[model samples]
Target: MTLLLTPVSLADRVEVITPGGNASLTPPAASTEPSDAAVETFPRTTAATGSGGTTYSPAEMDTQPGLQTMHFGAASLACKVASSTTDLVVINQSPEPLPAGTRIKWQLKKEGTRGFFAIIGELGGGESLVADDVLDGQAGKDDICIARVI
Candidate 1:
């Protein structure tokens, strides 16, 4: 099985669960103007700033296969997964002194289910796991994979 990485637009809105409630995060390439949803849901909007804290330079990051870029205080964390063979290889492409806890979790939508229902494996900070199949104990290859930093 092979998985191709898709680069999501910086303008694309990313929703996350924050302390206040549901907050919409704006990346480096996000829009300045506010959205109608934000206007209607003032308190819910909370903060619209980039979740990465610092901006990412072009030379630093891009939409590469199995590569997940995360922004820290002054350092940029690049999680790269080697060739997408039968087992997926996830690597840490950053400098030494890695963070204590940086985990990435993934969820897959079942085929017959209406949407993403099944839960998959998760990677924490500098840890790597073998991502063979999508669903738990299944060998199917038509599952939708969605990943998030947890």
Candidate 2:
């Protein structure tokens, strides 16, 4: 016996729009195999409201060892990671303020170990914050899954 399979064709270009910003994604060819790395995705129009008076969405999956952008509602986080160190720039464009008690937990996983960490960034209406060269020995170049709702 033999088996056969067919791959579906994808569009040449696709645009992902969230409250934070827009990202263009180009999918691989139909004949290509699925990638082992988890691709980062932007949240949709809907959002989850947290107890700290903030609305957020799940962020990106950092698979490679470089800079990646993660969008959470009106917050845009640009993270540059290398060797467990991260440089972050968070921006809030929503009309409502992000309270101080809000927490952004990041789930980090690598080849040998897996753990979680949290970071807090308070922002008023249309404000931004920058944290550079922050070290987290738990992070690695494998996967980082962020959750919604602060």
Candidate 3:
């Protein structure tokens, strides 16, 4: 897995916030993923308490920067920030094509807790999902955490 901590002004159209003293990203953090079949997620909220385990990033960046790609199983995951309130733009750009009727799993995490803002639907080789706002239809959370796509 990959953990990105892109440094940017919080005043910009996008704001990235990590825990105190976690304002940096170098070589991306080391995170482990589920086995080839099962998928799991950890939120920034639970990052500090050792809740999600030691494989997750302590900081979260705006997905608005777009397309953080990862390879696992039979596909490559391309995650992008559509908007915090709406949903993410996940594309399958696998070098090896997935089998027919293949589906992918995804989850967007939150901060200070092991809860999810949205649990997206399984996507196909050329499909996407919109993980609507979990904050009761208001704006999305500014915590801007990480996601698990498999």
* Superior by lDDT: candidate 1 or candidate 2: 2
Model 2: per-residue Cα lDDT at residue 51 = 52
Residue-by-residue lDDT tens digits, candidate 3, 1-150: 999998885652433566686544443344573222433454544345635555445665535324444455666655544666454555656554444333334444442322232323445566555544433333344534444433
Q: How many backbone clashes does candidate 3 have?
A: 3
Candidate 2 residue-wise lDDT, 1-150, digit = tens: 899989998875545679876643665445565553444556555464555544555686646324333445665332323443564334555666666655443333342332222446556766655545443444554444332224
Cα lDDT of model 1 by residue, 19-41, tens digit:
98865454333487665543232
Q: How many clashing pairs per prediction, in order? A: 3, 0, 3
TM-score of each: 0.24, 0.28, 0.28
- TM for candidate 2 is 0.28
> What is the RMSD, in Å, between candidate 2 and the native fold over all Cα?
20.6
> Which prediction has more favorable lDDT, 2 or 3?
2
* lDDT values, one for every candidate: 0.40, 0.47, 0.46
Model 2, stretches more than 4 Å misplaced? 1-85, 106-121, 135-149
Model 2 poorest ten-residue lDDT run: 108-117
Any idea what lDDT model 3 has?
Answer: 0.46
Candidate 1 weakest ten by summed lDDT: 111-120
Candidate whose lDDT is highest: 2
- C-alpha lDDT of candidate 1 relative to the true structure: 0.40
| RMSD list, candidates in order | 23.4, 20.6, 25.2
